[model samples]
Target: MMTRIKYRFLPFLLVIILFVSTLTAPVSYSVQEPIMPDSEEARKILEDSLSIVEIDHEIERITARQQELEVTQRQLRERITVLEERIDERRDRADAVLRAYYMGERDHLLVMLLSAQSLSGFFRILDFYDMIIQNDQQVLQSYNQQYRELQASRASAERNAAELAQVKDSLLQQRERVLALQQQVDGALNTSGNPEAMRALIHEFTLYWENVGLYEVKRHFQALASAMENLPGFIQGSKNILSTNGKVYTINIHEDDLNGFLRSEDKLFETFAFRFEDGKVIASGESGNLSLLIEGRYSVVDEPQNAIMFEVERLVFNRLELPDTTRRSLQDEFDMNFYPKQLISFLKATEVSSSDQRLIVRMELDL
Candidate 1:
């Protein structure tokens, strides 16, 4: 009987143990954390973020200029209105004066002078008629002068209007560019973890671009664009410039190009010679027995948008790869962001690529 009872209780104990185990089971979540992008993709995303920052700066500048144009245009318009009103009033007075003199006589001044009754009275009437004629001429002269001033004022107003229109168009274009950049950035960041850190890194690299590298390149491109306006003189008689249809142009740049372009700029890049090989940008330099090599990879990124970017991958000094901290510090200090916005504004870059011993940008001819 006891054995039977123990077996019966054993089944109950098993049931209780199973219940306990079920209650104590570990919990698991079905959703997974977002993973960061691969290094190459992340670098492209960084470039896009930097583009956003550049677009924001452009928008801010355009907005300020737009405001100035608006104010100037308003003031000019007011001046034009005042001038017009003044011209009209002056014309009315001149017309009244002329009408009173001419219609009062309804004949030549000679007739009026000859119609005097006595010789003495005729002389006096002649003097009075001469005085009226002189006054009428003065009125006409004053009216003409005022009318000329009105024309000048109107012309100024028209010039202001034209400039304002152009400014507005520029502002609109910049705003559109910023929107596109932001959308690209948003899409990129959504797939990325630690958005703030990514943004900070991008901002830091942008500072590098602005302060350290390509500053001269940017200024020269801006000046050239401004000087040319609609003229495509940049490619004329230039060996570095290549174009087939004059609508699409390619320019291969190298150490010589940079050296010529920089022309005595005190930058670390001056000592380096750059070349492309197997989709990588390699720079080698030496200074007083110290040798350095910087390698970057170039790729066409298409997720956020179709764009080409160069990202620094390795830094070797004296034939040894530098530690990560030193590499990162140097990269932040001397990141070579090669997107020339001024040049792009004139000739839109269609494709940017790299190959063995050559880095080339294929661009639409002009704006």
Candidate 2:
């Protein structure tokens, strides 16, 4: 009995040991590091890769849109051409009918009626007169129908041509935008010197622009507020900045002031107010010699809760001709390689002042 018990207990003990060994076997296996190196160079390389990927993706989307627009425009043009050809054919037919009438084709019918001899002949002439009248009426009706059709076709063709023109214009504008964006990416990539570094910077910049939406702006503001909660200076500044509706922070820096703001160099941040109509900026105010510029345009849409959105239509630069040194410094600081256009439909405002001049800044922030 003791030997039988010992055999069974020995088998159970062996099974437990096997189970424990199986569990510990995985732990004993050698661990390998990830393929990517944990260093700045690797990070930079990864970032660069991401940037290129984003640019490629954007280019693909834009190309696809362009192709679609081209196809649509081509189709519209073809339709218009067909309509125009039909109209031309109808016009030719109408012109032929008018020419026949003008050439005295009706005089021959009148002479036939006068040549009737007896009562039977007169009856036959009357029947023949009705036939001539019917024939002439039919021709006139057909001419009128063709003329109306030609007019309709011409109108349709004109409309189609106009539509095609619009599509072509839009396609050209989109292509220009794509080229500009591509150039920007290329410039950023080339400036880094290192291909990997360039890629990384591009990726970072792309990501920065991509995520800058209304929701992201609120999150950023919240994070900033949280970070400054315990700071003594921030706490003091926050109290003064708080307003009933929102907050107002004044920057007394000469560069920040609208009156002395260098419009030429700081065109990107100029105080050109927009006139909003039906949620679109229809016009922009021009700057004069006077420093104070007031825009009395009312908001088309109801104000959004917890946020304000402004559309930038124009940029007004300061008229002051600065010294060469100062001008160069301003240009360098503001990255003033491109001049801000008056018809800036793309620029959105992220911040604004409450003053009558309403000094607004178009920032990457969504607000």
Candidate 3:
């Protein structure tokens, strides 16, 4: 019975020993670590980043050039606008002057003179007559002067417009070139793996830059040529005429008065006018005699005899002396005339010598 009891207690003792061993045993657990994505995907990400950086650099370069072009274009446009405004102003002034001259607003002077009734008034009338004459002269002078100035301003505006057009055209071409370059760059970026595309893009950029350089060179040459062509005229025209000690060499008055003076009237008449100084005319005569040559030919004032005759090529009004009765009516009509100071100066500089029977004047012509 004692052996049987010990066997039963042995089971309980073994259970107790197993529980104690379990409690004393070191516990270990394995946790599986997740595998990272492939390096190729990461390399692609890095390549994309590099591509973006390259694209950003190209974009910056393009933006800088675009800004520069924009500024240049703006300046050119402003200059053209300013020139246009000036032309408009000058043209308006010319129109007003011409209208005033045509309307006989200058006749107001005669009215003022005639209105004077007393002896003092009569004296005042005489004084007014002189004043009116002076004013008439001034008006004609002003009108001619303004007309010439208007012509000059118009010419300048035309030049500026042409320059602006050329600039705009060039800018457009440059923009196209830049756009083409950008497209190439974009294509290369899209095909980053393709070496040939990248090389072609770089070549395109080089060619675009070269073209830009050539455009700049051409612009410089054109500007130089324009300056050279206009500078001499400006210098000669701007000289002081009052300081020169010379007599008026030519006095060409247009007959029609409407067409004004032209440079192509006739060589003989034009040359004679160019040579005849202010004091050279010992006698002056005008003939209304109209003659019909052979059949359908028409001639005015027979081909002047031995006397060197010059046909008035252009009539430049230096002064006007209107009748006292019509002065008031024409007052406002004549203004802003252009006096060809340079031409006048050239005429004044001519030297004249009188022979026994004829007067000879030396004149110079600009080619």
TM-score, per-candidate, Cα-based: 0.46, 0.32, 0.25
RMSD of 3: 38.7
Q: How would you encode candidate 2's per-residue C-alpha lDDT over 55-89 as one tens digit per residue?
A: 44444654665576567657656665766676576
RMSD of each: 24.0, 19.4, 38.7
Q: List the residue pairs that clash in candidate 1.
A: none
Q: Candidate 2 at 98: error in angstroms?
A: 3.6
- Model 3 stretches astray by more than 4 angstroms: 1-125, 185-367
TM-score winner between candidates 1 and 3: 1
**Strongest candidate by lDDT:** 1
Worst ten in a row by lDDT for model 2: 335-344
Candidate 3, 166-191: lDDT as tens digits = 65564565455546545655654566
Decoy 1 TM-score against native = 0.46
* Model 2 TM-score on a 0 to 1 scale: 0.32
Report residue 303 deviation for candidate 1 (angstroms).
Answer: 42
